[model samples]
Target: MFCSGCGQALAAGQPVCPQCGRPVAAPPPPAVPNLAFEVANYANRVRALSTVWFIYGGLSLALGIVGLAFANSFLNGGGFWMHGPWAHGNFPFGPGFGSAIIHFAWVMVVLRSGLALVAGWGLMERAPWGRVVAIVAAFLSILKIPLGTALAIWTLVTLLGYRNTSLYDQL
Candidate 1:
């Protein structure tokens, strides 16, 4: 027999070409993927991610609120040694240290929840800004351990693809 790809002579039962290493047998036809279906699927995935963003945002907001509630006890003179004269030495900022901590917690709560809410809305509506917000969220999410890391990686992969970008543009 002959290798159809390179036209090299081959033994009747040879599986591949000796000259070019091409398969002697004909290769199956390449499968043609459905473009429209793929685009629709991408859209669906974006929508699904939107839901996830909302969930994450809500969780962050709740946690932030909880943290804020407990910040005073944790940072201030309410816990152990809080009543001691050395408390001032322990916290150079003194009485204001606890307030500073509360402020910081509030900032975190606002920032994290705000970004998540914005990203979720944008993604759901397929707004141009949504992609930008999503990217930012992905980067920030990486700082969170475990679940956040996984979500961030998936978000980056899903939103950063060339085809996905084109798909977003169309949405």
Candidate 2:
């Protein structure tokens, strides 16, 4: 028989190609993930998600800093940080406001970055839940509005490129 992959000749009953050393028999196709592809695809998704997390996380962190600055201004009377306090609906120097704003912003940064780091690490370890986590995180990231839209679109592209497969196959 002829070896389809390399165009080599094989014995009628042989299961593999002697010249190229590849399986020639029509054995059942491999599983959906195909190990190597699964690893690669999962890694790619993790990377993409990481990028999105950084982009949005940076913005969120910056906004949180602004909130902190506003709260600080209240301590010594509203200044630049107090600009348009009425517009933002913030009370100048309210007790615990500065610390609260700072903590809130830092929490946002930690939340996004932590998830991304975990996703990447899990994917590297071939955790079955990594892909599921990535998909869920990607979806939640869409709440960032324009930036979130971009993230969601990029994630969709990655998923489409990888094709339909199980969470395990993904990582």
Candidate 3:
């Protein structure tokens, strides 16, 4: 029978849910195609995430470049070489230090972009590890400060609020 908690098919003669670890009412039926659907769903999420990552990565790279290049113009007291606490927060600073600082920022963006590329492709194929990748990537994105926070918040909403759009789990 189907598990009420996670919907994972229970194995025959099993007493507890394999997925949720909850007590089962009785022995379950054989596992079914929901596994297939789960994998496929995860893959689809990867593809969608890939597109988002690439887009944001590019934007992050560009913003970093601009911040660095025009550090003085955007300077509020901060400069390319120096950062005040609360970057997005109110502080004395320039846009950034300089081109070098921009380079560093873009480098981070590039890494995220690369991760997206890899996860997107693997997810499209429903690779067994795609879920892990997504989870890891989601965590990493949270560290990106403004960008990471935004991504993390949105992903959390998508994962928790909307059951129909479940990220990795499927029918």
Candidate 4:
């Protein structure tokens, strides 16, 4: 090694340069910030978010299926409330209007359910596109209110929070 002070050639582990008597300063150790806690926190949040997504998707799917069945029953004249003399004549919106609305609602429910399911799957699998899909789904879910709104906000914060972007990239 060469001494920094006098540029003198020194043997290994020398304490000082013999020519100039300059003490050898060992290089400082590389700085390595500990990220174990942050990583674990983010990982837990991701798992929880994905779990919530799955539960929400399942519930939505069930609700959509039930809604479809009810709509089918109503349209087919099988619902007791939709029968009798006042069924068709007393209806305010007239025929087929309610059916159209129900159809639209069921379709929306199915779409939302599908989106939630896909987001959950992507997140659980740690797919490259998972973050994007989850963000999109979270934005869409923000209007759902109560549980959905809370989940959406949490998801947004976890995935897009400061310093989280790089951590997720490592995953």
lDDT scores in order: 0.83, 0.62, 0.59, 0.83
TM-scores for every predicted model = 0.73, 0.47, 0.41, 0.68
**Better candidate number, 1 or 3, judged by lDDT:** 1
Global lDDT for candidate 2? 0.62
**Clash tally for model 3:** 18
Candidate 2 vs candidate 3: which has greater lDDT? 2
Model 1 spans > 4 angstroms off: 1-33, 77-90
Residue 84 of model 1, lDDT score: 59
Cα lDDT tens digits, model 2, 64-110, are 56865665455434555556644233547664565576567667666
Model 4 stretches astray by more than 4 angstroms = 1-33, 71-78, 83-86, 89-94
lDDT of 4: 0.83
Q: Tens digits of per-residue lDDT for model 3 on 67-144? A: 655653443334455455634425445434443455665577577766655554544554656545645666777877
1 or 4, which is superior by TM-score? 1
Count of backbone clashes, every candidate in sequence: 0, 1, 18, 0
